[model samples]
Target: MGSAVSSAAFSTRPGLLDGLDPEQLAAASAPRGPVCVLAGAGTGKTRTITHRIAHLIQSGHVAAGQVLAVTFTARAAGEMRARLRGLGVDGAQALTFHAAARRQLRYFWPRVVGDRLWDLLEGKLRLVAQAANRAGVATEAEVLRDLASEIEWAKATLVSPDDYPAVAARTQRDTPAPAAQVAEVYRNYEKIKNSAQVLDFDDLLLHTTAVLEEHGDVATEFRDRYRCFVVDEYQDVTPLQQRLLNAWLGGRDDLTVVGDANQTIYSFGGASPRPLLEFTRRFPEATVVRLERDYRSTPQVVSLANKVIGAARGRPAGSRLQLIGQRPDGPEPRFAEYDDEPAEAVAVAGRIRQLLDAGVPASQIAVLYRVNAQSEAYEQALSELDIPYLVRGGERFFARKEVRQAISALRVATSRPSGADVVEQVRTALAGVGLTEQPPPGGAAKERWDALLSLVELAEELAATVQDADLARYVAELEQRAAAQHPPTVEGVTLASLHAAKGLEWDAVFLVGLAEGTVPIQHADGDDSAIEEERRLFYVGVTRAREHLSLTWALSRNAGGRRHRRRSRFLYGLIPEDHPAARVARAQGKTFGGATARCRVCGGGLTATLEVKLGRCARCPSNVDEELLERLKSWRSDRSRELKVPPFVVFTDATLVAIAEQRPADDGALVSISGIGATKLERFGAEVLAVVRAAGRG
Candidate 1:
């Protein structure tokens, strides 16, 4: 509280952090009631906050465990922790709101929740889902699953069943069910959870807030423990999260929140940026930082994103998040419309194969869509083409019973140090699944659950040796990787709903299912804001493409000849003046695809192929040798099989074909090929050239 403590405790010299500008540093270092960083994608807002945390800790202002950094996702939290460690502040508690809530609930479950909570909650949900299905409220299991999600969201937003009709009538009234029914269902769910003496995910935060509110001393303890806080993706913080944040701060804490108002796409989940945007007004001492330099995308992609955003007038203006396109330039955003879903899928698959033949890798390509429903076509095509893909934001890892049980066991083992919870939960969930027929001999369950228990034990040992601040992060990261076959798709070729895909970027993005009832979203047209949001959604989708961008729309979908729908308004907006799509809808284009070449003599297709990304039509004089193409394709196929990614993904059909046709004799020749930019050349240039040379020899 004294001048010496204030000056000595927290200070940062300019240039200590990489990626952040001096302005960002000043804003981040400022101790204040509130600070807002309005940054575009990849301008290093993340880097700024990270260094800020490091500065706070190193200056002796905020103790290691006293600083809390909250992110929108568990993965993002892990990333921030890792980055902070890189900056020499390894112990800051970087966490997602839900994760923090979970910790709080677990630490005080006995006092706040009593002992009978867990079993009661689970049984209640099970019974409700069963009854709902039998009562014809929801006929199918999938419908029940959706209902369960709705139930959770409603509760998390603190919406009571009595409040459902009013809330539902006010927001998204067009949804199928009446507000009263929704309210009834919610009422039932609460009853069930209470009867079972258990809490669902929502209850974690709600109960934590309740505990803090009721126990002033405990709230004060936490506030004193973490004097400084940083939250990333602040635009998406829900009301529940805001409550938690308020509770943690105890009305006064140094806070830094960074987000883009344009990226406020998670409103369905109760996420909003009003809190972030209003920070300065709400807290008189708040400082605002705006970042416009886009280090993640190309000028072309950024310009398009800007234009799309411009089309939506209401959003708060900030620095333009431009794209500093990293990969070698290949193609601009493409626009295409197909006859139907299957044909569109086929075309996309063939394009990948062609790109593979040229030289682009499967790992560098992604097929993104507006909804999960659209993935079916791409999934089928990729499966047929033998493409290996990881879907992003598809399912929550904790939602998987197996993964949850495993993680819970791991947490228990880590918490107890001696591995008690691992023994308890595994036995409990296993018994529910009928995995354990009879009670295990004393300690037998713990011994049998070796895989998870061992990890818990390792975490326990890690905690003792590692600093407490670092122990949580260490455990979180290990659990993240160990909890699944794949880390929930933070990277790779991301297949995501446009909504979920809002904040991320990729090397090449293929936007599929750009048809009506999908992009504008069937219900989004009535409200002007909704329409603008749709446009913003399209903009979000297009901006995700760092280099190559493609949009595809199918006229129809035929599942056993039950023909489906029309082109999406989004695609309709892409047609050129002379194109038919323009007449029907306002389509414009500097379209990527024009015409497919066919041989004049044999009428055989003259498919243009790529060697990585250098494209050449079959008729191009610079084509690689036929035998070389065969060999390169064969080798690539083998690698693709091993990796499980589609062959096109392994290498674009175009890239493969270019290697064969343009037999790059050396590095110079290789660089001459398209898409063979500096990074690719440095990473795989020698091997790629060797493959070309060897193929030519064979």
Candidate 2:
């Protein structure tokens, strides 16, 4: 340590490793030579990686500029850079794979081929459509999109156009087009891209790997420049990415990778955990470290995550790292079942409202779903409740159909020689799409208009920032920004897809749509690997919770006036009927009658006559006063109409029932209800008590 410290700049920092636990400290200080850290969620993976970088530089084992740290997103790269700066380290290169490859390609393009590199193609679907036309592959737009995605997957897996059909056939993976037709489309796509002198995102890695492999001198230059390499989220690395890393290293062993195989949720994008799983075999001298202590979630949450991952199949032996909770004991993760999607959404919104009243910040709570489509119900429910929320990782603003239409019109309108002002062009585009300053009628339509307006504002701001900014340059910049756009931060509840929730944590998480076809995903029906990836995705969702966690699923989904669904198999053993963590809530449908009565709090059914007379299941507390509850509901309805808001916004039915049972006589007592915050108490507290008093007298 003494010899290593003399040449480094951070020798004076005394408490660099004080906060890290023993395992994390060992990982941070491990000797550098093909090191692999299997870091589970909330196990201080970022801290360990950043501290390891600092340790290497402070010990003088690697120069700051000579280290290359690769992350999966621009935000992650920024976070790592900030951490390194805090540790008194500078000049280290932290970049995403695409960013790093794009840089190298730009720097070495002239040296390698002596020709100008084309701009990356922004409209992949357009190119795919053109290819479809050339190949005479007449199909619906959905089929065309599926083909485009398959082409991307093939490219990432390094399958040639000629080999795509064979590979797909051998693997029996589902495809929208026939194998021959898909291959034809792929070949035509290549021709179209070559003719236009453009490259898509995947080509960035493909072309760089080609250049480095074809030119040993160029590879040697990179190898000399970057002496140490560290990769984050290594479990999601594509084969092509692995090859690029190997080419850059050129047989050197100065490599460290950190990831959790159980959190590998991107197999649909052709990412595989094999590179991480087989790190020891790839680098025979590798030092492997496992970080198991989870500092983010409570013991209950950690245990539930462990149980979910333990049931997953096809994981490598000894690869299942159980998380030892580092936080105090808390409530067990809850499971709620609903009759349908809309009912499930309402129940979840009510629960979120309760949590908010209990003083949990909205930002600390998240609603996670298996797919983007599941968000619509929750969005409607939250909107009805007047709850603020921000949807992440769903459709991008620029990708919306209306926005795209507007942009298309703008491109044409601005292409003229007269060259109208940016604002005028935006106006023209909106006019063409039948949009004006006034918002649309429906909530969804209004949202689309707002998104387009934001785009217009963004254009105006960009133009103002740059004097004489033309429409063409402005459009190019917009495309670039769209490609790199991360989810925006807003003060509201988060609604995100499971994929988007990775590497993020919350104090409470609601995992919705855990039904059979949704969680396992219909696409993974016959594929073992695909199913395993779905399980991993569930694991990722479970581990995102720091304290409170809830899993919800609907018994049916309505389509064309028919209901269909089945419970997700993964939840069978996890939330059995007798499980202490499980709860059932009645959906907005027919109630149980005859021989049994269902608990309104926990979905459990009560069969005995005494239990039925008590009007509560064995699991939850006794029922509220029915007549008083009806009076409260009537009052809420009248108040909602008076305020021109939804009934739930005034106060949820659950909150009203709680108030009736408590019989709060004043504002202070009213505020004690689960959903009655200070705002509600001040606004309608007196009226609520008057209703209660009148009901009591009656």
TM-score (C-alpha) between model 1 and the true structure: 0.68
CA deviation > 4 Å runs, candidate 2: 1-13, 394-488, 559-564, 576-698
lDDT of 2 by residue, 201-261 (tens): 9999999999999998998888888999999999999998999898888888999999988
TM-score of 2: 0.72
Clashing pairs in 2: 584-602, 584-603
357 in model 1: Cα distance from truth in Å?
5.1
Cα deviation in Å at residue 197, candidate 1? 2.6
Q: Which regions in candidate 1 have their CA more than 4 angstroms from the true location?
A: 1-11, 113-127, 130-139, 317-330, 354-361, 393-477, 483-493, 558-698
- Model 2 CA lDDT for position 336: 78
